[model samples]
Target: MLRITATATISLTVGAILATAGFLWADRAFPPPLPARLEASTEVLDRDGLLLRAFATPQGRWRLRTDLASVDPKLIEMLITYEDKRFRQHRGVDAFAILRAGWQLVSNGRIVSGGSTVSMQLARLMEPRDARSLGAKFRQIFRALQLERRLTKDEILTRYLTLAPYGGNLEGVRAAALAYFGKEPKRLSVSETALLVALPQLPERRRPDRNVEGARAARDRVLNRMVSAGLLSEREAARAAAEAIPERRLALPAYAPHLAETALRNAPSATAHRLTISRPVQSGLEAVALNAATRLGPKLSVAMVMADARTGEILGSVGSADFFSTGRAGWIDMTRIVRSPGSTLKPFIYGLAMEQGLVAQETLVEDRPSDFSGYRPRNFDMRYQGDVSVRQALQMSLNVPAITLLDAVGPARLAARFRRAGVMPQLPPGESPGLAIGLGGVGLSLRDLVQLYTGLADGGRAHLLRDGTELIEPSTASTDVLEPQAAWQIADILSGVKPPHGATQRGIAYKTGTSYGYRDAWSIGFDGRHVLGVWVGRADGGAVAGLAGYVAAAPILFEAFARSGLALQPMRRPPAGAIRARRADLPVTLARFAPGADGLTAAPNAPSEPPPQIIFPPAGAHIDLAEGTAAPLAMKLQGGRAPFRWLANGKAIAGLHRTRTATWQPDGAGYSTLTVVDAAGRAASVSIFVE
Candidate 1:
């Protein structure tokens, strides 16, 4: 009985001791590894499921994974050499190497070289951030062992290769290859492979172009290790060592980084989807912008953006390189940042008014001067253009006339116009009067402005804008913004402006804007296919007062549009309204202008064909009906070969001024005929068939 009892106590004590050791092992090992998040809802596409951009998501981060076969072998070889020598031969953990590592720890006193295997390194890389504890480590060890038992050696290596970061902002060999060499992983050469292979250890430092010497040394070490391990023969290492290394040209690292970063931010699942950004377009645009900025002089910081006009998805954007695009992360993303729109907004304002039924394309309004809520805006040149057609004022970019139209259309209504175009333009926060509308005090992103202008290019229809093709859907949701007549009217006006045609940008009808003191210079135009917007001037928000719209913004717009294949066409003019007939009896440059009231302007001998006029506002709205008035009104007129005279209510108003009002008494009351004749003999007249 005594012998049996002693044996039972011994067994208990042995079990207890074993339990303690197990506890200690658990303590030493850590938690389960966390894999880097691979998918971003905003950036990933089904077509590009293997290439995801990262973002915070509920289902955990997913690393975009491509076929292991697609990865460059040099990259695989690099990770294998740096991480584990006997990766193919080991189980989840290499016991012999573990012993050696234990000995090294005993002698050297810290966890340093040659401890973890490739599987271990990959384990650390993939481990969840929250699960990085000793107990979790042990748990992960078991999981990895399970992985080893279930999966082939090649599968483990493949996962490790796909999940590794190569350099810079690139998280995978595929991204790194394109980021560095602007090519695909399958196309990488030996020297290129070596450079890429050496990058995983320290992506920033090992960039061959930036630190070629360090990269070469790191690569040589990798090759020597491979040789020592008999993975490759001496002849192979010799040839690799002798290969020519290309000198790295330091392309600006921050080149449109803000653009991409903003895109990723706006695209929620971008990080997870491993967003397949068009590196070529990004790189090419940077180059194009750089040349433009340099030629235009550094005093100008240019922003050029190209988007998928059909869907409003910004394919690529180039903000100012002077700050973000040239170097590293900064405080601002200028592309998305807002600025005043200046004259570039006129087409939309008029286009919307025309579309909304607030005004017709043939609607005649004085372009001379506008008096509204204590504001009278002058043209850019500070001159009154007098009696001009809606088309004439737009083509001339007459500031006063645009303000008049805005007053008539109502600022609140204009704000609504911006929203309908897929642009939440920053208007005056609260409802005020007309103070901010015509002055351009409202802030708007270049992105928003680009989207807003799309309505014009799309011929009165609007679509929900997207960031990429993935976000687009087949929809009949398109709504009309303007009558085809009104849309064409504004488009023609923008295209017909003087010498440098300050308005038209791309081969498509375009418009230019100059903010106060030339703080911003802009050119936006479209051809048959593309819409392009170019912004130039100071990023510092300093005055570009002396700078003209033609200087940089317009030229760059033209150049980029040409390069991108937006062909210019003979623009279709606005709807017919006032007509001027070239009569043999009048001055050679003189012609007759006649209003199309009840089809009068179309009559023969009226001289020139009816001049384009506001037919219908693109948007589907109309203002309250106003009875025809015979009140004689004084006016100034523009758009003929020269300036013209005015007769209102069937009476001349050339020198008529009385009280706060200057009146032109035409022949009768209610609505009467008004007419104007220019020095060059072009005449413009409208009939008010009174109620």
Candidate 2:
């Protein structure tokens, strides 16, 4: 009777407990309450709507972003297949995936599979920019749910593919495609597509440059998965596995470093939409920098910037070594930093002074040593040339007179003008003293200096480079910033500026600058279309020193200008009205001409006989020929014994050996003038246009 009574009670208790448990289980819910709303930092792009770069904050670095449509599809497929096979079917986190993950946790020794959906991963990647935490993970999941509700599966896929990091500073598939195959993602072959897919799994380790074999193996493994998933055929998978991948990407920068330097600053502005930086011009500039650096050898580094004066578009820029060289980390954009501008700053000060009526074009100024508040400035040679006119001082970059002009203009106002012109530099309390400002001891970016010069070229008006294509809307700057007449006068001076007698006939309007102790060498010159700023020195970086300070660096500047298509705009030429011809002016006195005539290598002591006459294409040349077609525009003269010499583009012709006839051959795609100097030193000239 007692045992029956105890068993009945126990059974009753068990039944009651079971009923309560069932009710509790039915009432319980998953994924508790929601948290507060979260916001993400938005990335800004170039005028073309291309992402310029992103940073954690203002203090952080400007990180470059790769384009979308650049990544391989295989990578996208791999993540979806491995982590969430039913991602397309689920709203956000699949219930089945979660259930499977639970089973995996119990059955497997490690958390091998994640139930987290693609949307969840993207949410985390975009926000907090932080490491994984339980709370953070939950927040990510919540955002994923919101995203799933907001966007379609296709949109989610597109967003994920575009924003995902594939490795090597690449932000999207489009960038990966360009980096790996130098092509667009749509053009990727199955094998190449598979390789890019594998990189994101372990970016640092699988970087193609580091572990080509490992990346390939990972790619093959992913291909197996893709094939099994029926995205690609088994035959396709096999072919991809067997194929060799080209493991290289040319870091072809879309904007020249200088252009980037100029445009990036104004990205936050409303006008950030009109700037148009040309891709090919930028590539050519980069190519020049790289080739120059390589040809000079690794010990020397080069930074070059080329730009259009009218539009303010930087065509090419390079900060570090050439892209073709190995082991270069392009973290530092060389075209931005404001090095001591050297003599490069002189022209602007001269122009400003000229504009302010502080000095006129031909006003006599002293190039000899001068003092300001006990601070005296010396030329690069640390010596002085006696009294020089205002034009000569600027043309020769005469240091003492520049200081005198700066003293006259007052550094504070000039500094203000510099700021207005977009030059970013620390100006000494203008009230203090020195000629260093004129000498470019004032640090300013390459872009700022270029802009300053462009304004001078454009008739003393400054314009900011807005971000996009609306170039016609350049914000107007100070009017008459430079007097048109004075600026013209400076231009004339520079055209004829050089050494003892005259300047080189290249006729480029240029300025050579050297900072204190020769730490920097810069040459700023212009043709009608563009103004080129050439800075030569170290990139891994060091002060411009020794030979690099002078001979080595100066030639590079002149060479680049010569090679580029800068024309020496004719300054209001000297009136031929003041001159008359002497009957004897044709003879011995021809060689007795005054200094400053560019490219006048020789003059006849006297014509022993009738001079040579050009046989082909005549003087004002305009003709076309396929490359390497030799057309020696010959000359026939009475005296054959005179050594035949020729000049092309103001330099000596490569192959000339006394023969009376001179060949006017086309070298590159351009026009050149030929100067004929005979054995008797008699000279004649001709111009040829060749295509």
Candidate 3:
């Protein structure tokens, strides 16, 4: 009998050893697949990892990417304590939990509590079944055991946090936090963390948006469980439980919508895209554009782009006034669309002329009417200031003076210079470059305009704007758009221009441009560190009345600069070669600009004699004048030149002629005089009073 018993014991021990070895081999060979929930929605983030935009996943759900480190520590502690107390001790499945579950089922004649560990719950979420049956539970247990052999504790938790559904279309803790609290998971308060940790157990039944009372109850249950498990103090748990439940879901951050689309195009396969944009700056500029658009009336769109001048990093871009307003064609990204640039190119023409020694800031240039190959360019106001200093002519945006320079600088050469600056303006089809290009003849985009201005800020060197993704580092190859002296001279001239109404002096060099027929208006400006451009107009190329750049766009530009929260750094000082002397102090050839008979390059010499001078209404002459019964006064001139600028008091007298005499009509009885400035910078003024 003893021998027989020994034999049976040996057989039983051998069978047990074989069974154990088989199980170990199976665990090593066929571990559970880490849930195949890899399809995540594309997320666009700002420079600091702040969410800028998010898209729905292929399955029409918001399953944002999440990890253990990105969640609040308090939330993770509560989650593990309430869901799986032995999560750290067990490999995956807890035998004690399964036994307790079975005992409860047997005692109640039905399933009462799920005694499922977090890992098992994760497995069920990975391979979700329609019905909660015994078969599904068994499968979850098997998958959990397999997962234990393949992943670490942290890895399992991350999978659960990422895949767990949190009601409706929202999945994952990050998505839940953003939807319920309008904040990131990492910034959750104690109450917020408890609510987030409680959602996945019964998402639909406890969804705060759908059932506030149910959500509160579930959150309280979590708090009570945490207290019982010693994970939280009773007082703290009660306080958290008392916190109000969120009753509504919030939309995610949606700034830089167009930029987000661009990012997706740049990296279509990426699950998350990071851009070089500042959240605060972008948000502020969006508001600026929207408010400006509303005030500018219907069908008017506003676009802006701001960048780091030195590094060429695009900081913010507002594609349109409102992304959803069809009335303004807001769907179109105005920053990228080409439109006539008006007088924006005049500054570059002046810069080129300065670089070539063709003109100096104070050098006198004729602003009178002139014809260049039948071009006959006229000023915006249809009146001339005669011979004005280059500085005044540029500040006033005199078209005749700009065309004269462009005629001398050759449109082809200007186009080449623009190419060197890393942008190519679009000339009208079937047309060669011409003087018209200097004044709104060519098409350019807001981005291109901003880039050129940034080049000026960088001392004439043009750099490619950085996209913030770092997928492609900025190139070292830079183009010299202008000489340092020329850039400084242009910046100096523009900086002195008067700011638009309601704007403070910001020490910024800026220029405004109005396209033909009021189709496009632009304001491009820069200080030492940043460059910004603003464009306002209709997207369909239709003209909008009263769309002058100085009045419409400059105000928006100044407001944007103020809202950006960036320091107003002063522009670079004049370089060594820059000239700072008066017209008379300059070299004889550079002192005065007298266009040649051909109406192109500077003449060989200034006129031999001074320009004609007015000699009428001798000093302090008072003549009887009335508003309705005022006789036209005859103004006489002495030797100088014709087509002179005759100002009655401080207003211009219309029409240009070589006649030695001119007529003026007084508006009312007041102190007034006739002041004439000839084409040679020679001026004579007489004081008179109308009684």
The predictions' CA RMSDs to the true structure, in order, are 13.1, 16.6, 14.4
Which whole-number lDDT from 0 to 100 does residue 20 have in model 1? Answer: 67
lDDT of 2 by residue, 276-300 (tens): 5445544455556666666655656
- Candidates' C-alpha lDDT: 0.57, 0.57, 0.82
Best-to-worst order by TM-score is 3, 1, 2
Question: What does candidate 2 score on TM?
Answer: 0.48
Q: Write the per-residue lDDT of candidate 1 for residues 1-691, one digit (tens) a residue.
A: 9999999999999999998687557545643443343342233432233332333235432233455688766656655665776788887887777788778878999755555676665665566447445686555556566557556788777666666666544555655565567555777766567766777766677776678787788778777777787766888888887875544532323334554455555554444333323444455656666787777665667777766555655544676744533332223555566888787777766765443333333345566655565776877888886666566778778887677667655676777766665567675567553645566667887777777666666665555544443344435365445444446657656666543645343345677788877787777876544567777766677785566665557777766665543335444333322122122322211122222332122233344533322122111222223356544334333343323344432223444222222244333223233454434333454433322
Candidates in order, TM-scores: namely: 0.57, 0.48, 0.82
Top candidate (TM-score)? 3
Among the numbered candidates, top lDDT falls to: 3
Clash pairs (backbone) in predicted model 3: 611-640, 612-639, 612-640, 612-641
Off by over 4 Å in 3: 1-31, 35-37, 104-112, 466-476, 577-579, 597-691
RMSD of 3: 14.4
**Residue 270 CA displacement from its true place in model 2, Å:** 16
What lDDT score is found at residue 431 in candidate 3?
A: 82
lDDT minimum window of 10 residues, candidate 2: 591-600
